[model samples]
Target: DQTSKTSYDLVVIGARWTGAVGEYWRSKTTYEVIKTIQPPVLVAIGEREQLKRFLVCTGGKEFIEQAVQFTGRLAAAVNASVTLLHVMAEPPAVYADMVRLEENVDQLLESKSELGTNLRRQKRELERLRVSADVRLRHGIVIDQVFEEAREGDYDLIVTGTSQARGLLRHYIMGDLTRSILNRAIVPVLVARAGPAKPGRTLWKAIKGLVRTR
Candidate 1:
């Protein structure tokens, strides 16, 4: 008899814009975004886990460098691995244009030419950081694909970012992807809010400061 054994310390689902943003913050700030998350309940699991792996699910639209950097840091801190997953949704024939846009890997790579360059640089950094990492491209619903991977990979935890709500009504409504993953995920989940902070401003400010100094 053979036992199927796969394990990871952590797995982050939903590699959307928010996830990328979270990665950026984590890389730059000394403050622990996951630890300092509002409500405190969200990151409890991540804090408790010793060995962690981050599995970031992307739609192929997001910049891979951000995810790589974030995971690289977490992995180095926890001595874990970072895995990237890209999921594709199928559409009807009438949506050929949309399908072409989504399915054309070459075009997608070309479109984010700068991001691709950044990813290469980050990959080198990740290697120096000694974090094991790999990227996978798959086809299916984002939520379903993540769940399936979680089970198969035997991930101990999943982390994702949420949207800040404006009011009580908005708070009650979970974004579709978050809602689905939360409802179906078998493992513990860490939800971080991707608040409306302008992450780029810090870089811009630094640039301006350099100009003044010069």
Candidate 2:
């Protein structure tokens, strides 16, 4: 329930065998299970056994901690390089900022201040695990910018987060950006869940899973 103090990412798990949402929705009679789960469920469509590079999508502080920790652990496990990316979504026309003549909209919305602070926090977290990564800033639609970076970098995986949005507002936030990336990405996208486990637990679990799988 939204009223609960516990925080975790809300994920809608469907059949791995099918990409069609309509078909997957019919997997169970109940849909409320999306809100609660004991262990995080991970589904990876990409078949890579070794991770080399990562493209992490961020939205300032909105990017969940679990995702950042998971990404760092995975990178440490495989000696992978990571690139943190943040896209400044186009602003409304009324308070319109400067736009590039060739591109749709190009302007600064304190991407440096917001994304900069986040970059430092994440890098510090990664440093605790001895994982160093690069940071990149871009401008445009969030989903589109992410996909483009993924394509250009040929990242082994795309690690991102989904907010625990509730009610009708959720419809506008959680499903759109993540689902869009999931739909078009050729690599695996790990949806980082929030709450519990802490960073230490997350890394320990990932190392164990890697051992078992590899």
Question: Quick one: best TM-score, which candidate?
Answer: 2
Model 2 C-alpha lDDT per residue in residues 1-214, reported as the tens digit of each score: 5324575433434434345543221233122332244323344555567778888887656346667887788789889887778777675675454334213312233245544556667766877888767767777878888988888888887876555544444321235776666666566666665432223367889899999998
Q: What C-alpha root-mean-square deviation, in Å, does candidate 1 show against the real structure?
A: 13.6
Q: Tell me the TM-score of each prediction against the true structure.
A: 0.49, 0.60
lDDT by residue (tens digit), candidate 1, 31-131: 23333334312322223345466665543323334444555666688787766556667667798796666455445444555434433455466788898
How many residue-pair clashes does candidate 2 contain? 0
Q: Which ten residues in a row have the lowest lDDT in candidate 1?
A: 23-32
Worst 10 residues of 2 by lDDT: 22-31
Candidate 1: residue 134 Cα off by (Å)? 1.0
What's model 1's TM-score?
0.49
Candidate 2 clashes between residue pairs 3 or more apart in a chain or in different chains:
none
